[model samples]
Target: MFFLPLVPINSTTTLGRQSQYPNSWDVVRHFGIRLSDCFVVTQFSADPRPTTASDALPAPRLIALDWGTTSCRAYLLGPDGLVIETRSNGKGILQLSADPATKDAEFAAELTRLCGDWIHEAPHLPLLACGMIGSNQGWAEAGYAPLPSRIMAKGPALTPVETRQGILHIAPGLVKDAGADDHGLPDVIRGEETQLRGILSGKESPASSIIVLPGTHTKWVLLDEDEVLDFTTSMTGELYSLLIHHSILGRHSIPPRHPDEAAFLRGVDVGIGTESQEEGRPGLLTALFSARSLAMTNDLTADAVQDYVSGLLIGSEVAGFTRRWVGRTSTQEPPRPSITICANPSLASRYKRAFLRLGIRVNTAADDTTAKGLWHTAVLSGLLAKEKA
Candidate 1:
């Protein structure tokens, strides 16, 4: 049996209004590709034709998209899954109209506004998407794929949504059942599985590895080769946002002009109990108040308070995860698995620092995994015709 958490998108949720039509030149410049290059085509005939210089260049094959809660990213993938061009906007699911009467229309309009040109130029190419766009509150619910499954397998079906442009195929999220064991809690993952598929396609390692995706709800996935053995999620990022915006801890915080590394590391030490003088050190609950008290006492600057609190939350999350998953005994400790962080550079750097402080070295995966994952999935699922040698 498979189940997914259906968190409805609040109609009042506001991520700020985005322009209905984005500037095309700006998009081309941002993605570093020519506007004309995106629409190039090579006509074929029954008569034998010699390959031209243009024919040697990779041609667009798939229109891949990663549509999440707060943003949407579209990619034009060429032969062998190379990205030819890309576009992004703030028109996520949360930005759509809350009225059920017009929600579907809004989504369709957003999709066309985002990449209607690509769809128009490459009508022969297939469209594939992965992310919250497949959620219950999204344009359509793609459902969930059961656990103990191969990440690249094509058994589970992709949900198809009809639109003015074409039929968009949405990949299903993954769901794990609660077993009668230590790691029995049920969990669900949307979009990250495609990123995992992208990561595994590039590198092959015999030993197991941990893939950490940092965001509002961070996912710490356990990957054993091509299969995901188990995983866990932490709401550290969301908690930090709430504390900095809604809680008393953020009352005095003024955004720092520059990041305070010293203050952040200090908070990390406190949260991890490394700064504790006594054997019975106070835990995270007690440590959290220090953010407010230290600011009031002038021991910590108003500017540095936010970073300090961020480090504290992240440190506590990392410490808790290691304790639960990486076992330690009196005699000896088990070998830690290799960790690969898949995130933006800033977040990845922060996580790398946290892991390094604990003497664990980790690698950051490429930024194009989502696009590559979508292309790979489309190819594996028989959406694309086999390329001629």
Candidate 2:
């Protein structure tokens, strides 16, 4: 139902004895944050709380907080979702003490530092939060809502934690019941609730849609109107990154630039091709050989080689999903689900072009589609009431 892709950034290099977020590792972390397989960190901000008690000045309606693994993102949204101001802090859930002894205190302190002033402005104003802050490792595990239930469903709500500053609501990640399906399906997602909700909010009456959220573990979410129907995951992005940058494939090719359409599409072509291999399909090895082989054997250009590499990754992803779709058990005609690609514009644009070129129609959702969807779901389901500005 609700689709949220969780992609963890792998940090193989250990931080030296610097007692600090090491610069070299930090670059990796920054790259990991940007190229994170799980979630995306778009912008960061810090804004002072309103202090004037004048009746003419009203406090912000609700604060949309996306407290993730590596960062805390807070948005002071107006009644219409227009951001009045935003704030962020380096204190993410991972940084919180998992030891349990100091977790609560540290979590509270981080929240206070980031939002205490804002709470003073509107002590009674409601707050909505989503992401890992509510996961098993978070301050509190906000239990999941079941299939066909929208993100804002009343089935399982956020676990509220009260502090001297104000009340904090932590969004729960969706987790399927054990043995829900074969392979002991243990599907769970943290930060994607808002994104899925944002997608539903765009429509007057949500249709039966299948959203493809491409990343480390690509999520294929099936939605029936506002309700989440079912879902599955694919390790597309993570595999590509690992094979190209770290694994054996790295021996051959150069690093790729961000927004490299040529490389991305090239990956799609090779990966999605029917004849990849039955034996482990050493995608990286094949891609490496393709590049080196091209250089050694013929007079191919660097750009062409890059394109070939990209095709290998994307091609694999497409091919895998195609198998899942076609091999799915059903006597009925294939689900007439619209493919909505929810991701960054650049990625979405590339996917749009690629899918189109392959005769697949995909509608690209807005950039902030996830956050907005979460807010709208909350409002529609009365998990959050519409603000009166």
Each candidate: RMSD to true structure?
10.4, 12.7
lDDT of 1 by residue, 1-389 (tens): 11111112122211111212235335544665633353212342466355444433345688889999989998877777766567776388888847778989999999899888777766778999999999988999999887676786553478999988899999998888886653568888999988888887756754677788888999988767667787777888998999999999998799989888988888887776733335888878889999999988999999999989888877777666666555421124333777788998988887777766666667998666887788778877778749411
Query: Which residue pairs in candidate 1 have backbone atoms (N, alpha carbon, C) closer than 3 angstroms, thus clashing?
Result: none
- Candidate with maximal TM-score: 1
Model 2 misplacement above 4 A: 1-58, 88-90, 152-156, 178-182, 256-261, 274-310, 326-335, 377-389
C-alpha displacement of 238 in model 1, angstroms?
A: 1.1
Query: What TM-score against the true fold does each predicted structure earn?
Result: 0.82, 0.71
Error of 2 at 90 (Å): 4.1
Off by over 4 Å in 1: 1-57, 153-156, 180-184, 274-279, 329-334, 387-389
The stretch of ten residues in a row with the least summed lDDT in candidate 1 is 1-10
TM-score, cand. 1 vs. native: 0.82
